[model samples]
Target chain A: MNSYPVTLKQSYSSALQAYLADAQEAALMRAYELGRQATENGLGVLDIAAVHQEALTQVLRPSSPSQETLQTVQAASKFLAECIAPFEMTHRGFREANAALKQQATQLANLNKELDAFAYSVSHDLRAPLRAIDGFSQALLEDYLDKLDAQGVDYLNRVRNASQAMGRLIDGLLKLSRLTRAEMRRQPVDLSATAQAIAEALRKSQPERRVAFSIAGGVTANGDPVLLQVVLENLLSNAWKFTSRHATATIEFGATWQDGKQVCFVRDDGAGFEMAYAGKLFGAFQRLHGRNDFEGTGIGLATVRRIIDQHGGRVWAEGAVDRGAAFYFTLEP
Target chain B: MNEKAILLVEDNPDDEALTLRALKRNKILNEIVVARDGAEALDYLFGTSVISGQDAPLNPEIVLLDLKLPKLDGHEVLKRIRADPRTKLLPVVILTSSTEDEDVVKAYGLGANSYVRKPVDFDQFSEAVRHLGLYWLVLNVPPRSKGR
Candidate 1:
């Protein structure tokens, strides 16, 4: 049917004329229905007021008696007030919702500021004590080595190792937080080159691991280069770590079509996790493997998920116990 | 006072002791002048207060400044150090635990000669200080002080 302000104007004129001619309750209900229909047709309060003014000029002619004109004006105001009632209620609803939304926004802004201060203190103040623990332990090992027995020396070494491991954990935590807060500069990023660079770094880190890398060329994306690098580094490094036990292993980096969209993937024939534990993959510090099996702070997949989420993409995994694992992700805007 | 003493501006006693030991191990045997806070650092460098017990500012060979300090912070101290004509060209190296990008930007913007995060691993921290000492003190030449 026709949905226009012209329809509203015509309906409003007829309703007012009917009400003036009959002076009945049914006529007043028509005036109310006209107001509701005008709102539905996307007409504003001013538009309805203009329609009502036009109707009044034609209804009240100068030839009518002055006393009769007074009565007609008063009676017509009753119908006009009923018509304007719906518009006032809608405006009131808008004001309430707007105020509530503003209040929620203010609360969120304050929470963000507090989180920034907390992260700053954690970065600056917390490391000093950890450094002192590691530094003093080193001093004891260097200066009092002759005084301590073999077992005592071993204990000191353990203390130093524990402190250093804690240092690594703190560093990892800082890195994750920093990446989330970092400013993103999105551009066309070369995913193939990014994956290749990470693979090279991993190979150089452990030259004895006889791992084969099958990275597809021309894999590209539109995302923040630095953040996309983090995603590839985490996934590839995880692949490299899980495959350390094998004398020789193969890892692949490529993309494929999924539901009519391009999806990037990293797959490895490594110590793949069971499908039962796959639900815990993207959580921070979530690990399906034991520490002795693979040494990690359990932040790699979590970091990858965070970056992908910020890019408005989704990440998922598929694996079978000891068979292999494949990670698929998409980058949109 | 006339000796090319090294001024160490630090707040934490542990870091102060650790840094001193690191420097001494590197054979940086210059006379060390330690200021425990930013205000004391300014007092020693400008003779702003009688607490330092020097008649004039003790222009050290280098100032190893820490960012987080009591009474005054590192950035404000660097601002004042660069503001004064006598100490404007003084070499100030920021040594702190913060690797935050904004802190790095602010330090360099305020005329910091170098920025180094105090590594948690003592071996790496020791090596970093050793190279730092050899580079800034032995190799890098200091300009003649304008306050002279």
Candidate 2:
């Protein structure tokens, strides 16, 4: 592209100069002089100064370099070098500008990732207290509403309801943030011990419930502890919560090897959700049961799904309304 | 006989109140000496020019250092404490709100004996204080004291 432009400009200017030097064609010579002045003043079709000396030599003599032509070549070379200097500088500047723009784009992407992580951490950390506040407040209102005057009871109930809704909003925000921030760490996790601890805690929460809770031992997998805990917590908490309706609530937390991958499941016998809405089970704020029937922020399953994805794993649920729900998750080998 | 002393270095009033309440609730029977900022903590620790009117020369069994503080930060205070032979190996425990891994690693690197993340919830916060006081005061044996 560069060589062709230089050649064309040289040819065009050489033709004009030839016309200017002609004796018989005085009118054409006058026209050529006028065109040359206009070109010098930046009023013509091209800048003659920009043409290369080699291109001028090609226009003057199509073949061979000569001793007499050397002076003309040098003059042409000087003019061409002067004209091309600014453009070369400009081209270099443009390259630097483009590189800077690319660097800024990378920095912006990094900042966005950090912001997502910050939002996730904040939301998750904040919810623990909000849980204690909302849960305990509701318990207070439900268990001791009669001792207080009407207005006082109403105020406490309002506080409880508002906090519960805030909990839902917080949970949703946390899931959205976790979609970007959550990263997978693969390490061998003793699933049996984790399940047993969760089961014992659940049973301790309700001693008289008479639930036959069983967790198979020796189940292990490689995954991020925090994310895997989220999966287990959600699944086991769901199982424990749902099975509250049964007189003999039976729940099992275990893992089985399926197709060379560890497949963990939390199986329960209680108010299981319908299979029709199973597709929406992992969606944020998508609740299978009514708020009155089941107490949930509805962000649990969404978190479970996100954590599994971070591990490059998969999650699914199977259940029939009023029978039971079983959530299955798989981790990399 | 030296009355057992604890140097509580904290900035925020609410946090200070919460911490004091937590300590008291956990039956930490030591005479608690409070420093509102890092400068004050230093003054009490090293007997700075601002607080030279010593009723007695100050020496605390344990310094509960909070990482973030106004004026001089927790790091500066820690450096000052560790620099002097009198207070070197004084069993500093960093108690802070931040759970950032860098801070954890840095605190331990700076010769802090233990690092405890300050829990946000009231009950949990109090429980952590209880365990902390019990562990530092009764369980872990302090090095033999140098003559004052």
* Number of the top-ranking candidate, with lDDT as the measure: 1
State which candidate has the highest DockQ.
1
Ten-residue stretch with the least lDDT total in model 2 chain A: A43-52
DockQ of each: 0.80, 0.10
Chain A TM-score of each candidate structure, as shown: 0.71, 0.56
Clashes of each: 0, 0
What does candidate 2's lDDT look like per residue over B33-96, in tens digits? 8887888988887776254357444778798999878999888888888888778879898988
Alpha-carbon lDDT, every model: 0.86, 0.74
- Model 1 score (lDDT): 0.86
Candidate 2: regions farther than 4 A off: A1-112, A120-230, A252-264, A274-299, A330-333, B26-29, B49-57, B100-102, B138-140
Candidate 2 per-residue lDDT, tens place, A1-333, comes to 235444445445565556545635764665466556543443323243434344465556645658678677767678667767787567567767988999998998799788877775676457555545644554466557777788987887677666667755765665556554545567888888888887888788888888887888898888776667667877888888898888888889888888988788899988998898999999978888887888887888888887787677899989988888888888762
Backbone clashes in model 1, listed as residue pairs: none
